[model samples]
Target: MQIADRIEQALDRAVALAQGPGAPPLLASALRYAVFPAGHRIRPQLCLAVAGACGDADPESADAAAAAIELLHCASLVHDDLPCFDDSALRRGKASVHAEYGAPLAVLTGDALIVHAFATLRPVAARDPSRMATLLGIVTEAVGSPGGIVAGQAWECEVAVPLADYQRAKTGALFVAATRAGAAAAGVDAEPWRMLGDKLGEAYQVADDLRDVLCDSDELGKPIGQDAVRLRPNAAAQLGVGGAKARLEDLVRAAVESIPDCPGAADLRMLIKAQTALFFPKQLAREAA
Candidate 1:
């Protein structure tokens, strides 16, 4: 099967697993609503690709890792759409969970997805329970606590939080987790492979910041100008749009360079290229007129 097709299959199965069979009708409905017709599932796709490049990727455990990480991502999006947060009514070009299911159900669906992420990991956990436990701990830490995405969100409330800290927590954490989880799933235990997570995570953050400035809401499928509208600090705010795009290119180059260029990293190199291609001058093509 083609690589993208394989990733899509894993994503579809994850959407189903997140729903499960015995969930309450309300919960099942929420699950279907939150995940179906979702975004690209890029996080899990990145994980699977990295795993495959590195080694066998052990089909048995790779799906578990993909499904678990996807649930985590879906949960984050559900919470992100809450009234207290982005407070948006649209996601992926459709009404968000709260908009369609009501606030209470939306909250529960987010909570449930978080729990299911770990639950989905049980099979891989069985392969070597202790290692799985460690992986879960890393994922949980990234999603919660003082230095994670939850904390990243909380920073907006703070009187003085570093922009780098906020961006890393909010965007970079998941990229880091995806790579780490992929390495674990592949049963590879090298420091270099593990470190790929951090590099990719930071690279993605830079790319996202560039997009928020250059891309329109119609293209992004989320509210546009959110950072500028909210007066939040962004790469575009600190560095000009032209400069932010440059930073993105630099980071992508750095991220790809951090990993040893080899047969294993060939596809990963392509993935990085595809991501950075959209960031700059085209953004001002019309404005230049």
Candidate 2:
């Protein structure tokens, strides 16, 4: 609740700024529509969880990083659902930004949210220049080239999209940033925690793959089976349903094992386990059984 509250407040403030008297009403509303009511908030929660495990040297800065990661995530979803991309009409049980506010505004709204993501970090940068710089790089790289979300999205356009690369960039990059930035915010070396985030992120993507195949729109709070509809690369398609479930289980185990030695290692491990249960829902397990 604390983490969610912080995110809500920050998003509200950002949207409020964009809702100035001269601001377009629907655009401002669309921004709020895309962010609010929140999803699982898993990335930001992981960020806060990692910071807590790492000692939380600066709570305020840690909060900022979590907020920034979420903003970037929301921005990605908005852009991802545009007509040019996934063409998803629903998000979090509501109309997608593009569906609700038209495509052009959706594009600008996504762009504005990306800018807000960085702006959200400025206060942290002012408080600790080093941490700020590190976080800036972490977030930028997570959403940018080589192995970022952008690259991940681009893989869909490729004639031959590598499964590992696409999954990592499209989903894992932000998760990596979450854990690494959390550790960085807490004045620790973020490298040891990198694999934990990667494994978790991979697990997340696999779970999503299963969900898209096994679930329905009402259950998922969004459109399901989009990968097949769009002909995009998906684990369930590449590996088959059983194989994807096995892969998801393997990633979950690896994620739990990858937690490095830290002051709160035990708690972090437990956190990973609890989160894993959510990823591998009881229905999934039962259906497989």
Candidate 3:
């Protein structure tokens, strides 16, 4: 099966298991709204790729991990769009969960997706309990703890926060988890592939920052300039648009260079590098003569 089809099926199964038995009607709807027609299952796809490149090509084995990371990503979006955070009205070209479902359900939706992520891992539970446990732990830490995405958001509220630290948690945490967990699912050490994940995430954030400036609402599927309007410290805000673009290129090259000598690592790295080319040229075209 195509990787996209496989990832979608895995997502379906994961959400199904999460909705088992006593799901609240509103929460179920909220969860569904948050996940379906997902803008880009980017993190999950990267997870599957990293695992396969790291040497576990079964795809099915990596499915649970992919779904797990994507679920958490969905959960994060549900909360991030609340009035308290980005106050976003649209995401992936539709009303955001909170905008459509109400704040209470939005909270429940995020929480449900988080719990569902763990539940989805049951299929791989027996294959590698230690790795599963490690993955679960990593996911939890990446979500909302002192150094997690939640904290990353909270840090923005503080008087001062180190840009690098915020960047790692807010954007890089889930990505790092995606790559590391993929390695764990394949029963391999995650260290060698961690840098690759960081590079992809850094490039993602830089492009995201650029999109916040260069891309239009219709193109981005959401409001543009939310970062500047909200005073969110982004690469562009911190480093001018030109600097941010350069930073993105730097990250893309580093990510590709970080790949280890495994037979599949180079291709995996190139796949990630391709993403930079995808976003950069589009942004350039928008400003061209």
| TM-score of each predicted structure versus truth | 0.88, 0.95, 0.93
| Sort order, TM-score high to low | 2, 3, 1
What would the per-residue lDDT of candidate 1 be over residues 1-289, giving only the tens digit for each residue?
Answer: 6656666676566667766777688888888778776577777777787777778457656667777777777787888889988788888888889998988999999988888777777776667876677677667876886666787788877777687788778877777777777766777753465456666666566656666777777787877777776667688778887776567667767777776433578777887667545433355534433
Among the numbered candidates, top lDDT falls to 2
- For model 3, residues 1-289, the per-residue Cα lDDT tens digits are 6668878999888877666689877777678789998668889888888877877844555888888889888888888889988889999999999999899889888988888888887766677677768777767776777767778778778767677787887888888888887887777777777887788877888888888888798888888888778767788888998888888878888888887767687788678766557757385646642
lDDT tens digits, residue span 196-228, model 2: 999999999999988998888998888988988
Off by over 4 Å in 1: 260-263, 278-289
Which parts of model 3 are misplaced by more than 4 Å? 285-289
Please state the error at residue 69 of candidate 1 in Å: 1.6
RMSD of each predicted structure: 2.8, 1.7, 2.0
- Residue 88 of model 3 has an lDDT of 91
Higher-lDDT candidate of 1 and 2:
2
